[model samples]
Target: MALNYDKIVLFGDSITQYAYNVNVSPFCLGPALQDVYTRKFDVIQRGYGGYTSAHAKLMIDKIIAHENTPTSKVKLMTVFFGTNDSTGPSSTIQHVPLETYVANMRYIAEKCKAADIKVVFIGAGPFNAHQWWPTRPGNPHNRTTIQAREYCDALVALGKEIGVPTVPMWDLLMEAVGWKEGDPLYGLEELSAENPLTEYFVDGLHYNAKSYKIEYDGVMNAIKQAYPELLPENVPLRLPEWASLTSPDVLEKALQ
Candidate 1:
C-alpha cells in the first residue's frame, strides 16, 4: 500500500506532553512513534505542559493558521486533551464543560480536514486514583475512577460527530488487569521499574517513561486501525511477555 502523509502532529496538555519535560524533542508520544514512522514521516510533538482544551485551542489555531504549509506536508494530527481539564491544583480545576471542549476539538478537526489531514482524537487514558494519584477527593487511596473516563467518552462522542476517528484509550486502560491483586491497574512501582529511566509519573498527573510506552502503544494501534497504510510495512507482530498477562480479549480486539 502507498503511504498516507509525511508528518504527524500531537497536541495536548502535560500528560499529552508526558506531563513534564523541558526543551525535549521526543516529549512522549512524539518520540515513541518517531522510531516507528522514521522511514515514512516526521512526528511533531507539540505538547504544552498544564494546558486545558481551551488553551490547547489557542495553540492549535496558531499551528493550523500559520505553521501549516501546503508544501511542508503533514498527513495526520492526533489530539489528546481533557486530563488537565479534570485534575491538578494549578489546572483550571474544573472539567472542561462538554460543549466548550467539543467546540475546541471541532475547530481542530475542521482545520485539519480542510488541509486533508487525518484527525484522531485519543481519549484520555484511565488512571487508578489509588496508585496514579496522590489523593482522591474523599478517599485518599481511591476516588471515583470513571470521571476522567467519562470526559474521554464525551470526547469520543464529539469525534464521531465530526467524522473524526477516535482512539479509545480509556477503554484500553480500563480493561487491563492490574499488575497485582490489590491494584486494578498497573501500580507505579511495577511501571517505573519497566526501565531504569522509566518513572510511571512525575507527580500524580503526568506520564514518566513507563506509562508513555503504554500510552504510545494504544495510540499507534488506534492509528493503524484507521490508517493501516500509514504504518511501516513488513513489521512483525510481537507481544511483550508481560503484556500477555493482561486480559486476552481486549488484546485480541485490534484498536480502530
Candidate 2:
C-alpha cells in the first residue's frame, strides 16, 4: 500500500514494543492512536526490547532518515527511554550514565525539531523492586523508585530546557495508584494471578492492559496540553466527510 498519511513515530524500549502486542492484550497504545487518527496519521512503532537511550542516540539519525521519505512525512515523534537506562551501572549491557542519558535525550529532541517534527519525552515508569529483584538474583537490583524518580526529574528538566513536551510517566503512575515515596515497596506489589495489583502490571516493570490505558491517557493528555494543534480534532481529516458528498463522484468531491 502507498504510504498516504503523516507519521507519528514511537521510539522506545520493551514497554513500547509491547504497546502494539494484541496477543498480550487489546489495549495497545500504537493501535489506539492509529484508530483515532485513522486516514490522517500513521502511528509507527520503533520499539526495541532492552534498548537504552545510549542505543537510541546511536541510531536515531538513521531511523529518522528512513522514516522521512518522499511519501511519508514524520509529523511527530515520542522518545520513550530511561527504563533500561536507569538500570544499575553494574548491568553493563543496559546501564547508561545519568549524564549521558540527559545528553542523549537532548540530542533526540534537537534532531526531531530540526526535522520540523513535534516531540514528546516520556519519563521512566515506576519499577516494582520487590517483584523484579528476586528474579535476577545474580544481577544487582539497582533500579529503585528513587533512581527512576531521579531520571524522571532529569527528563522533565530537559523537556523544559528544550521546549519539548514531557509525559511524566513515573509521577503519573504513582499518583494514579495513590502511591507515595518512602512507602514500603513504593506501594507496588509483585503481580500475581490473584493479586489486585496484577491489573496494573504483568510483572513489576511491564504494564498490563489496564496500566496501558493509563499510559495512553497520560500521553494523549500531554499532547493535548503541549501541542494542541496536533490533536485529531484540530487537524483536518484525511478525506472529506461522507455526509458532505452531494454527488456520486466521491473521488472528485474528495479532491475538491
Candidate 3:
C-alpha cells in the first residue's frame, strides 16, 4: 500500500487510547473524524493510557516517526494530557509540578511545530474530587475540579503564548453537565450518576460514550474556529463525487 495519506494524529492518555474502542465507548472520536474526512485523511490514535505530559514529551518523536515519511504528512496533531499530570504531590509517580507541566507542553508543541504539523491542546476534563478520592483510598492521583481548572487555564494560556489552538475540555465538560465553579461540591450533585448527565461519564473521572460525543463536538468547534481551512468542508474529498458520474469513465475522472 502507498503511504501517501495525510494524517491527523490524536496523541494523549487513556481518553485518546479508548477513543477508537467501540466496546468501551460507542462514541469513538477517531472513527467520527474518519467519517468526516473519508479518504482525505487518515486519523491516527496515539494514546498511551496513564501517560502524563512529561512522559509524552519523552516519546513524542517515536510516536510521530511513522508519519514522518516523504509520502505521508502529519496535517494536524491533538495533544491531550494533564489528566494524569495534574496528580497531587502525594501521588509521586504521576504528579508533574505545575511549572514542569507547562514546560513539557511547550516542548511537545515545539516538536510538533518543528515537524511542520499544526497542533492543538486539549485541557483536562472535570472530575469529582470527593467521589474520586474515597474510591482510590491512598491514591492521590485523584484530582479535583478546582485543580483541573488550574491546569486547564494553564493550557489555554500556553496555547495563546505559543500560538497553538486549544480545546477547552474542562469548561466544555462542565457546561455539558450544567456545572458551575462556585457551587457546592462543584455542583457534582446536579450531574450525579443518578442524574441524566451521568451518561456522559462512566466513572466521575473518565468519559462514557455520550461524553465522548460532546468532546468530539468541542474539538471540531475549536478547529473550525481557529483553523477553518482544516475543516472537512474546506478540504477536497479524495475522489470525484460519485453522484457526478454520468459516464463509464468515472474512474478516469476520479484519478484526475
Leading candidate by TM-score: 2
Q: Between candidates 2 and 3, which one is better according to TM-score?
A: 2
lDDT for position 91 in model 3: 74
> Model 3 off-target regions past 4 Å?
1-3, 129-141, 187-197, 243-256
The superposed Cα distance between candidate 2 and the true structure at residue 170, in angstroms, equals 1.0
Candidate order, lDDT descending: 2, 3, 1
C-alpha RMSD of each candidate structure in angstroms: 12.5, 3.1, 3.1
The better-scoring model by TM-score among 1 and 2 is 2
Q: Number of clashing pairs, model 2?
A: 0
Clashing pairs for predicted structure model 3, backbone only: none
Candidate 3 accuracy as TM-score: 0.87
lDDT (tens digit, per residue) of candidate 3 on 183-251: 544524234434433456666677778778877897898789878888998876776667877786885
**By TM-score, how accurate is candidate 2?**
0.89
lDDT of each: 0.62, 0.82, 0.80
lDDT for each residue of candidate 2 in 52-159, tens digit (9 for 90 to 100): 999999989999999998877898898999999988888899988889999999998888889888998999987776566567778666676667877999999999
Candidate 1, 1-256: lDDT as tens digits: 1232357778776666652343432355666677776655667777777677777777766776554665456777888887656543333444466567778888878878887777888776655443444444443332223556667888889877777778766565545433333543433333442322113445445565556666777677766777776676633333324556477655454321
